[model samples]
Target: MRKPCWFLAPPVSRAARWRGRCCTGGWRVRALVRDPFSAGAAALAARGAELVVGTFEDRAAMRSAMAGVDGVFSVQPSSPGGTVTDEQEVRYGITIADLAVECG
Candidate 1:
């Protein structure tokens, strides 16, 4: 087998050049967005790919939003006006991951 394409942003792309989902020979691709507009989601859906849109900001809300998803892509959401401390960001990331695993 060649490899799995995991488009996990710029940093993670070196390992896997993530591309849109292709069902031709067992290729699966997905994108994590805060929301999936109908036009884009419909286009991706037409190609037999999935676009996960978590319609929430809070952890519990996001967990609920992604309740049935197989895997989760999370970012600790940065704000220009109010940036979180590194420690806080780490904790937030962990919380999201744990919650996602729990819900899934």
Candidate 2:
């Protein structure tokens, strides 16, 4: 039987941990990354993750990333640094959850 495919979103370190565990368990790991060429993404690729280049705000990309995956592991960015607003974080979380249900 084929093992399941998992779609993962970052903070890279956490996703990398999950990726490691999943890869070790013989499951396919797919990662959603804003920049595929970034060092973190490259590290993930080297560790056997399939990188899906996109941001959480991009619904089309999110859908594409989620396609055919058996599970999704996502972490919405917190707004402590003002990089992402509270509302935006909520929206992103809702969008990802909605897309996961829709994709499934």
The model with the greatest lDDT is 2
| Highest TM-score against the true fold, candidate | 2
- Please, what are the lDDT tens digits per residue for candidate 1 over residues 4-67? 2222221233322223333234655454444466554555556555555643235545555455
**Model 2 lDDT at residue 80:** 73
> Over the stretch 35-65, how does candidate 2's per-residue lDDT look in tens digits?
8888878877887878888888789988987
What C-alpha lDDT does candidate 1 achieve relative to the native structure? 0.47
* Backbone clashes in model 1, listed as residue pairs: none
| Candidate 1 TM-score, C-alpha based | 0.43
Clashing residue pair totals per candidate (backbone < 3 A): 0, 0
Question: Candidate 1, 51: how far from true, in Å?
Answer: 9.3
Q: What are the TM-scores, per candidate, against the unseen true structure? A: 0.43, 0.86
